[model samples]
Target: MTAPTPIVLLHAFPLDHRMWDEVAAGLARTHEVLAPDLPVALGEPLPEPALEHAADAVAGAIRATGPGPAVVVGLSMGGYVALALLERHPELVAALALVDTKSTADTPEAAAKRRQVADAVQEAGSVDPVRAMPDVLLGETTRSARPDVVERVTAWIGEQDPARVSWAQRAMAARPDRTDVLRAFDGPVTVVVGDEDSVTGTDAAEHMVAAVEQALLVVVPRVGHLSAVEDADAVRSALADLAQRVHDPVA
Candidate 1:
């Protein structure tokens, strides 16, 4: 029997571990899977000033498993956390699947917008960003046509904790550019994004592809920001293939 590679899946911001449920189920047959929620309250307050909280706390969850290395997959905020895992917990990350995320740090204008929204949400509610996020993240087509996708996102947003969202926003605003993490690593990497993922689109995946030595890029069609929900089958296939490449490069 082939030894199974450990798979640790990190979810996007505001959403919880459940976001990876379908994809995890697909990868489970061939690998051991761990999915942890990233609620600020659930873990520690999202690191102040930058990604400080992310590297240690989130990556430490995978580290606690006692494995030398594991394939780490993350989406959006989850992708940020995955980069954190690679940077601070290199020994614990054998490979990486960066889904619907970018390697560059937040731009000052973007970071300022995030801070402004974070402030407004503190006074209002996390739901405000949750509602508007789909517009910014998803393509115009997905927003107009996909009701099920819309419903799933609505459910996810409704469940998030406001304080957690507030903290994560600030954390994201302060994170350093991690493009070097991809360029410097000597390991397998895959960058997956939905075809219509405006928030992190083909451009982001292309940047990632250029950086990693052994990397694959996959873009799911007719989907948007939420690939885990919008194009889960595509996501599953990508992860399965990535796991195979990591486990047996020749196979």
Candidate 2:
């Protein structure tokens, strides 16, 4: 049998490759998976968080996996980097899965907020911008019942490198609207969002799903921005279906 296509897993902001650990482990049973730490979150010297630079870094990782395109799965900021990857290296993507993310650029107000957060991180040397994020990142059900999930999210936010967090903020602020890029992609696309996600929500996912010619929208119930962590089974199943589509495009 031909080898399954590689799957490149991109993580959300203020978090490292660990966010995808559970999902990746499950997927690894039948596929070659590469979960890369985005440049800023790697705990090394912070590079200016340019979206293109992050894309380039991920592209390099993908290339190292071997020849041919790979399925790219990105969440939130990782979704932005995934779009950037599609922009920078279209031929390297076999399929695309965007979770809890949008294809639009940040609004001016949002950009300003990002700048403010970046400045605060720079001055305080902390990831305080995400201090109260569990409420925003998790849904009512997850928050009320999954204390383990909530604690892990909080700990992940706390362990972030401050300088890298600031860089990630600036990089996100610089991303452009990628709806046009989606419109141009001919490969399969999957847009997944939590029904209760306050960050990007259903409308955002719908917009991208509508833009892509061969795209499907999946709204995971009782979850918020972090669907993969909050509802790993649903996400893992969605990704498995997407991978099947990649292998059998006619189906």
Output the worst ten-in-a-row residue range by lDDT, candidate 2.
Answer: 39-48
Model 2 pairs in collision:
none
Which candidate's TM-score is highest?
2
Instruction: For candidate 1, report its TM-score.
Output: 0.92
Instruction: Give lDDT for model 2.
Output: 0.89
> How many residue pairs clash in each candidate at the backbone level?
0, 0
Per-residue lDDT tens digits for candidate 2, residues 1-251, read: 88999988898887888888889989999999998877633436656668888888888888888988999999999999999999999999999999999999999999999999999999998888667788888888899999999999999999988887888899999889999998999999999999989999999999998898779889999999999998888998899889989979866
TM-scores for the candidates: 0.92, 0.96
Worst-scoring 10-residue span by lDDT in model 1:
40-49
